[model samples]
Target: MTSSSFLLIGFIVYNLAFLMFVIAILGRKWAQDNPIEHTRKWGNYAIGATIIGLAGHAGFFFTRWYEAGHIPTSNMYEFMTFLGMMIIVAFIVVYFIYRAPVLGVFAVPIGIIIIGYASVFPKDVQPLIPALQSYWLKIHVTTAAFGEAFFAVGFAAGLMYLLRCVNFDSKEKGDRKEQRGVEVTIFSLVMIIAFVISIFGFNASGYHARFANDVLYTGKDGVEQTIKQNVDYVLPPIFKPFEGEQVEMKPFLGMTEAPFEAPSWMKGSNAGRKLNTVVWSIAGGLILYGLLRLIARKPLGAAISPLLKGIDLEDIDEISYRAIAIGYPIFTLGALIFAMIWAAEAWGRFWGWDPKEVWALIVFLYYAAYLHLRFSKGWQGKRSAWLAVIGFMVVMFTLVGVNLVIAGLHSYSGA
Candidate 1:
């Protein structure tokens, strides 16, 4: 099969595994089977399906790498898919160690969501830009992404622990505070789902909006000059580019123009377009979250927490900590040490304080502090789980937010 076919197969089987995992958890009360036997049977089936799916995912990676004549981690699309593959690898490791079928209930969905998110970006194989043409590209990027994959699994386990332990029915102040935090965590995930849905929905409808902004730059002769650049938006234009005018906009909701201009301080590459996408994602997320809340008649976290009945809280808490602990050293090696080596080779500097570089340091330092707190202050259970969840958010911002919202030496990767 072709690389695309391999990807399709992986996607299909992953969904199958997710269904099987759900059955493993929720089907224990069915008719005559012992609960343990029921879980074991279906969990084995789910794990078997997961292994097959992972093979297809790996096939897609190697085949695409051969076709492109370079590693497939250079751009957002390829990197996200690679990250999804590594998530499965990490999950498999943890599943075998814990023997917890319910882990699949949380982990598989994260892999599916990440793969779906990867589908939102362009998939064409492009020639490497000069800076990315080094052997370190494969070493540094793959190692770092593999480490981040463990963090994704850690986020899943951590979130699961929160859902399992938090008292959804309590009115105590501390319990209510934890409940709200869990609710917000669920909402943030919904926003990511909204972003993927909004992109696919708009692009499928061939929706298009364009704006032209005048950019001032220093010319070859060192004279100030201005040029107009076109910015395109697939979603409805909620805000125009900074000091930009409409080039074309399909009328929608009886509106022919954007109602606001991007703020002057928001001046990154395609900042207004990115801002508009963010607005759409948040609005769509609110609508989705509101509809779910109405249907469930409770906080979404509260609605879902019942699924974890009889689960071992300490087991999941340990899983969360172990996953983060395993990832920490790999992340240090790939994200900081190897990254600095590659940067120095390509740019003649170990560190230039570029936005990406700065954020990478921030991520490294944050996790270092996590380890410190865990070891020195005996921070465990809820506090440690919270740190794992928040640290993954930091990793994502370094991976995604910096790329989309900031222009620097690493801007090409965002493309």
Candidate 2:
């Protein structure tokens, strides 16, 4: 009925699609007869569910856009949700092109994780700031997100290629290196999931903490003034703001206050809280990884490599390359060309070395290099797949890290 309802339906349906995809890919071994036919049947069910889920996701977007009287890409929650939706769109397109149900097995879960991560942000619709009040908001942000969505698909395929090909049991140096890289990637993903889980877990228990810090700011009168800024934390404070006073804190595990202060170099509005989140995510990820290792009694890669047994490594490698190839030009247009045009209109400058802008350039150049090496240098297979995976990380940092960690003209989007 409502946008939120539509989003919930989308989330649930996406999860169903993921499950169906898992069954489609993994069911072949368990099929009573005609494994190919079994996979085809379940794969069809998964794709159908995927389409239904996309409809719901689109419903959420359009309904929210109608309710807000603006495109729903102005803030963290809306943008992340839209990004997740676009990822689904990209996945669907790739699915139809390759007819690879296995792609769904990895890609759908990424969309789910993105939406789940998005839920951590505040969702209340708010009026756009002057900077975001432009037609380019619709064109630039959505295009950028859509391009990044394809990159997300590429990451999924690249990861699948690694898991499908890497020798998890071998003791050779190169094999071990690939194995560790996969493990680290898995650990990073676990950290993201862990952070989402921790946020929800603490929020459910009504955990809250606040710290007040005196920050020096330049006044309009060309004078410096000290202002007291308050930072809130939903998770426990492992590192308090530098020279901050405790406003309010809830004791947890006999910990009454943060054990350390954030480094002086960290100087954003919520740098300390962000740092603490990073720390917590790492700790939580290590714990989760350990639990998983204990259960499987081996590296996580080794455990996952089996599901990909019958998969052709070359096909997924092509999927990875093609996805990146298609996404690169879109990303260039949206993230670079359109972005610069918008920036010039909004701030009267075509290029500013704001952290966000710099990172956007970095993303553009990184992918540009990826394409050059892919087409010119004959870097395919493991090399190209690794590039695709790492390229998405660059895209993510530009989208997320620049917003949250680095204070700049684009910082308003973080709010």
Q: Highest TM-score, which number? A: 2
- For each candidate in turn, the TM-score is 0.95, 0.96
Measured over all alpha carbons after superposition, the RMSD of each candidate to the real structure, in angstroms, is 1.9, 1.6
> Residues 1-415, candidate 2, lDDT per residue (tens digit)?
8998999999999999899989988888889688889888989999999899989999999999999999999988999999999999999989899989999999999999999989988888899999889999999988889899999999999999999889888999999999999998888788888889999999999999999988889988999998999989999999998888999999989999999999988877688887887788889888888999999999999999998998888889989888888888888888889999999999999998999889988888898898899889999898988998888888877877776577788777753
Candidate 1 residues 1-415, lDDT tens each?
Answer: 7788899899899999999999998998682558899999999999999999999999999999998999999988899899999999999999999989998998888888888888877788989999999999999998998888888888999899889888999999999999999998888888878888888988888889999888888888999988888888888898889888888998888989999888888866488877786788789899889988999999999999998986898898889888888888898899889999999999999989999889988888988898899899999888888888888888878877887677788877653
> lDDT of model 2 at residue 173?
100
Off by over 4 Å in 1: 216-226
Would you list the clashing residue pairs of candidate 1? none
Error of 1 at 206 (Å): 1.3
Root-mean-square deviation of Cα positions for candidate 2 versus the true structure, in angstroms? 1.6
Pull out the clashing pairs in model 2.
Answer: none
Q: What's model 2's overall lDDT?
A: 0.89
Cα lDDT of candidate 1 equals: 0.88
**TM-score: model 1 vs. ground truth:** 0.95
